[model samples]
Target: MSEPNEALRRLLRESGWTLSQCARAVNRVGAEDGTPLRYDASGVHHWLGGTIPRGQVPRFIVEAFSRRLSRTVTCAEAGFEPQSGQPSQQTDIVDELIELGRYDMDPSRRGVLGATLFSVTLTVPDWPNVAGRLVAVESGRAHRIGVREVDAVRAMTEELSRLDDQFGGRHARPMAAAFLVNTVGSHLRADASEPVRKSLFSATADLLYLTGFMAVDEGLHGAAQQYYLKALEYAGAAEDHLTYCTTLRGMSLQAVDLGHAKRAERLADAAAAAAPAAGPRMRAFLAGQQAHSYAATGSKHQALTYIREAEVAMEKAEARAKAFGSYAPSSLAYHVSQVKYALGDKVGAIESLKESDRLRHSHYRRSSVRYNSLLAERQFELGHLEEACSTWERVLDDYPLVSSGSADRKIQHMKSLLRPHLRNPTAAHVYQRAQDQAESA
Candidate 1:
């Protein structure tokens, strides 16, 4: 027989919820995750008495407590073992990636995955831990792959990235997930010459990174981190420093966006440390993120120093025709705006954001909506009601064309911010338009 779940009992007591209330909270979380459960007081009683809840019930319980306590609660902390068949730290990266991608591809499973809590305490493998660690698959069904397969994967990744930029991840992520499951998974298992194998891994790593970026765009932070970890694993296996560092930087961006400044700073610093030999553009990219994160953490001197470094590297980078990833002048400007805002220079941040919008590429429709909405919010914060309304109108112009969770969140914020100012004609008009867009959406 299982031992009594003393830890869970303690947490339950701390929550001050009766057994029935606890069961109802779990049921509510399950319902939100699209897995309706009729759990009752008996279920909580059994769990408290050492009975293990089956399937995803433990996760639901953990989430319920987390919501009540307003903090993360791990399975171990809740006196539950890790779920059977769930990916663990010891799971094979390739197999785990395939499973994650397949789940992402299935519409029915997507809701549950989307409801996953973004753990601030997620363990990320360092460069030394994962570097060159991938072992060859010894399956009898493993086939041979070549340069052709590698090129095809890279081309497909590029096309999906373009689609993500033009529309949003909501429209492109499913296709990417399908490709990862049906095509890239097989390629990873296939045998290849040493050089071809490394190239294939590198290409696959890039695809994983893009898919993770799309997951972030969809507000699937937990899923995005899983995809990014796989990308780092693949990049490390391939000895691809660029993708490894880039994936870390992407995670930092996600953390900062979610208001985890210290975690973001640590990740940004790790990205910079991992890519010791990065070029000028890559340096600019990494330093720009570091600046924003540091500023967010209230490190004024460090933030200014890193931003200066980014500017110098960007100046040198512009002399070359080739770009490193998508870290253009526009992206740099956005980082500058973030840093300025973090340091309390709201006006400077606005001006920098305007510069970013001006320099932004035409294909970045999703970014336009997200950033313009941010600009409008800042404008409203500064009492520029009419100007804020004007900017929000611009956002609505492109809002219908984009399908991004981040953009949707910004529009929601616009409505809340305009509520008190509804007496103003422009604010009332913008709020109505946003309402119409939300209903239509």
Candidate 2:
């Protein structure tokens, strides 16, 4: 009925385990992971008979296989789709966020962290229309929230924002997630009045959005996707249109990074539409995102058009610092690199990246490493192997300090690029050093 579950059948054949045994293993694994699933021989037979299990069963099945094989086994390979469908209520989104953080904390379930693709759902969440009441504050227990409390959250965000620049999300993601779980989680549901609740929502939205960025840096795109969506839902609830638009831009950036360029362009455009009267900083940021997506999609004309528009907006911009980071000259240079690379102007891309390097922010070490890796690759592309190799050395010096999946990718890519040049002593040394780094980590 459902294509005979051939993928699952194949995996089963390779594992050399009976369906019943697999069922027991899966159920056991689920219990260990805190997801109590009740599966047995019949359930396994049904799945093999083309009845795909729903809920978290798919994840459990994959995890079971991962344990048995001593390697990661993704849900897709087990013929399972992601858990989908819009969460019905605002509280549901909050609840989901909390669970996500907990799951992230579990080292056993961390294999699911670097999910390969993003789930696409662009339904403008209808959360705001459903309810107008805030959760009741606990009597004598709910922390009294005022402007001061909100400002404190903002201050914390600003500091972490700088750290995220200097060290990278690998360095900051756990703290952000812990902050969400330990501090922000209770505030979302714990009592407050109209104005206070609104401010709380807005403040939490910024932190959640940053958490999403942290997820991105860790190469957990699916986690980032949920974090962004939940932040957007919070923004809508807060009536913070600017944050809503900014969150949308963050979502667009994630999609582009994941290579869903068409959807990325759509998301970027949606951000602009959400805040048609946004200030120049956001306007330039959105335009730059749009241009990158266009370039990715090979729409050079539209890409260049948006590029000019972004530069014009940047020129008119005032430096307003927020949790999103101040829009410095480096930001524009970063966009220029993307645009030029997309247009097949390798040399121009390299130049833009180098300039951006000078203006780069403190805590964005992951992006710094990533873009520099790009710059090195570009240099290699232009037959400047010595320069490229030198750049690799510089990035390698910092790579071990950050715990970013994105940075992991850049390092791995750098290693691959060195493979062809093993004849060169410098490249050989870097390659051996990468091996040592991998072994030590």
Candidate 3:
């Protein structure tokens, strides 16, 4: 009873139209327009199982159904809720957005969105093709200044990153986005030298990437995907290899989160190839990303291979050089552990995470949030009911908004693991306490 299917059923029920009737209507209209659309009751049934329709088919479906019922159609109305549950098998706005983000990360992956219909899930109203056609925009004409202003823009970008680290990205993302669009964007259009212009674009792209990532963390996925695409364009123009690699990694991460493991792996591989001369830290980051992709695809051997590669790369990275915005060894290890956990190697994941913590003395607030969830997972897997509950309690206290994908998934898994233990009074007490703390927090 997925929303899309339910919505289709409701439309049929209200309109008193058979599934074949709706399908015929869509096909007829599409044929007239030289666009083919095909669907039936079986299709509707599949959509109910969370299948996403693709290309103009979704719009065709909406229009056909709307015409029949004398009402409007929306993705949400059709039960294609974005980010509320498992991704639909049919392509929708979510699929387009994620694909757009991935495409932006690795420009080599770019293609007509329509062609990806069968491969993608769900339909999105605003596709990436629309974004690609948009020209570079300079909304703030008066903000234009000379090369001297470039330094100011770079500084502002760094300051924003600092703020994001201190306060969560959610709190700082809007301000950062505004600065990129208003300030750094203006600099890009200013009368600056080629070098200064390139620098400005890179800075702007980084800011945009940060904003998009923060939005992703906040579950504003479609919006995040759009932002990532824009950031990728800026990075391409700047020819900044590192920023480009990071942007692609961001896209890969989003794809993996959406369960598009194959796409994620392709993106990560492209990122590594793009930055062949990447520093140790950079290589480590890309390798770790590949590891995640492998794990998600259920390729245990590949996951471990990339994880080990990341470790080797990090070892060769200079400590001082790492200060200049490189992902540390510990950070890479943390990523590796995430992959292991995804592959259900709980013991291996826990050991890797513990080792990562030991090496990477500094903890990212964002990472700490993920780590706490992971620790609870490890405890749950080990059958330490009370310990798992206590671990979750600590996580709740540390990061209250633990309802995002990573945290929510961990909680769901742990709950399933603790179901049998719930009958025990002691275990139940701890679990309830943890749940209450999590809910209230």
Candidate 4:
């Protein structure tokens, strides 16, 4: 009645894993996702013999192979049919965004969404392909909207961003997702004047970008990419070059954080190319990211050139009275640190990171935890055990206040790095304190 899964068998052969091992890996992924399964060798055998695994098992299987092979493994590649209810390429952007938001807001679905694998081979639509391509969503009961609605969306986005900065995405993202599903979706489907409609699209794009950024802070990389793609669609539909380029740049940040250097370089360059008329501050923001991506790709000369451009742009830009989440001197410093580290200048990286921390704003508590932990790791690398311990203590101080996946990872890494040095009194004390914090968390 069914054809054998030759594609999956091929991937299984490439993975060099026994049937039991494959099943165990899927089960492990399920457990991590809080959807524990009892898959076994027989399950794998049946899957390979043409029996389709039901209810998210296929996703788990693909993720397991992706992990083993260190690359993405899609369902089609594994000979599985597309799951029902999953969005297809032909789905409208507004509908896709609403679906993503709804899933993100639901507690039962959130775990599965969180476990979605970040695909390195994801196809990114170019500016030319997406620009001004708004699909009209006709509704029979469309309500009239105006400038007030646009302003309200903008104000809410700003407030959510502030909360994310003060606490972390883990605390703010749910509220943002709920807002997107309950309020923004209806607004998108409402009738409006041409100018007001475009303005609404631009404002909503900004909110989507911020929501994606918060998803990244929580380590939901794949879900973040989905949010970013929707943001790009909306920004392009609005013909808003600034937000379009900004969303691309945000996607680049996500790729770079996940260690996809070449992809990051491509995205950063695309962002720069898309916004030729960007202001000094935006240029600095874009160029700073370009510098890090270039350095990560081993293009030292290009990296230095971009970093210099960013520095010049920063100097030319006027100071903003309220630059909450805007790119500033500290962000540039962090980029410089990343470039220096990538180029084998560890001491230079440390100095730049210290400068970044000093220049950082007080509201960015999550950033403080992440960057300070990075500083401590560099210090440990340079054999400054006591100094590293002291830096880690600072991280612990802020760790309790921020609920960020990135910060959690940094603390976990700190513990791992201090293991060999635990014989030292300072290292042991810091390790114990970190252990206690982690347990409480």
Candidate 4 local distance difference test against the native: 0.86
Question: What is the C-alpha lDDT profile of model 1 across 1-441, one tens digit per residue?
Answer: 888999999999999999999999899777644478998999899999999898778988987888788677878999998654443443566777788887789998776566565555677899998888766665445588899999999989989888888788897899999999999888877877889888988888999999999999887877898899889989999888999999999999998987778889999999999999988989999999999999999999999999999999998885532222558899999999999999999999999999999999878899999998999989988989999899999999998998888888788888989998889888999999999887887
Model 2: pairs clashing at backbone N, Cα or C within 3 Å: 137-191, 164-363, 165-362, 165-363, 165-364, 166-362, 166-363, 166-364
lDDT of 3 by residue, 14-118 (tens): 777776776687776565334656666677667656688765566556656665554556656766543222222423322332334443333243222212211
Best TM-score among the predictions, by candidate number: 4
**lDDT of model number 3:** 0.63
CA error at residue 302 for candidate 4, angstroms: 0.9
Give the better candidate number (2 or 4) by lDDT.
4
- Per-residue accuracy of model 2 over 302-382 as CA lDDT, tens digit each: 999998988999999987747463466787898889989988998999999999888886456766788889889899889
Candidate 3: segments with Cα more than 4 A from true spot: 1-148, 320-325, 342-344, 359-363, 400-441
Q: What tens-digit string does per-residue lDDT give for candidate 4 at 154-240? A: 999989888888788887898889999899889888888888888988888899999999988887877888888888888888898
Evaluated at residue 198, the lDDT of candidate 4 is: 89
Cα lDDT computed for each candidate against the true fold: 0.86, 0.75, 0.63, 0.86
RMSD of 2: 8.6
Clashes of 3: 16
Model 1 TM-score relative to the real fold: 0.85
Question: Candidate 2's error at 119, in angstroms?
Answer: 1.1
TM-score against native, each model: 0.85, 0.77, 0.65, 0.86
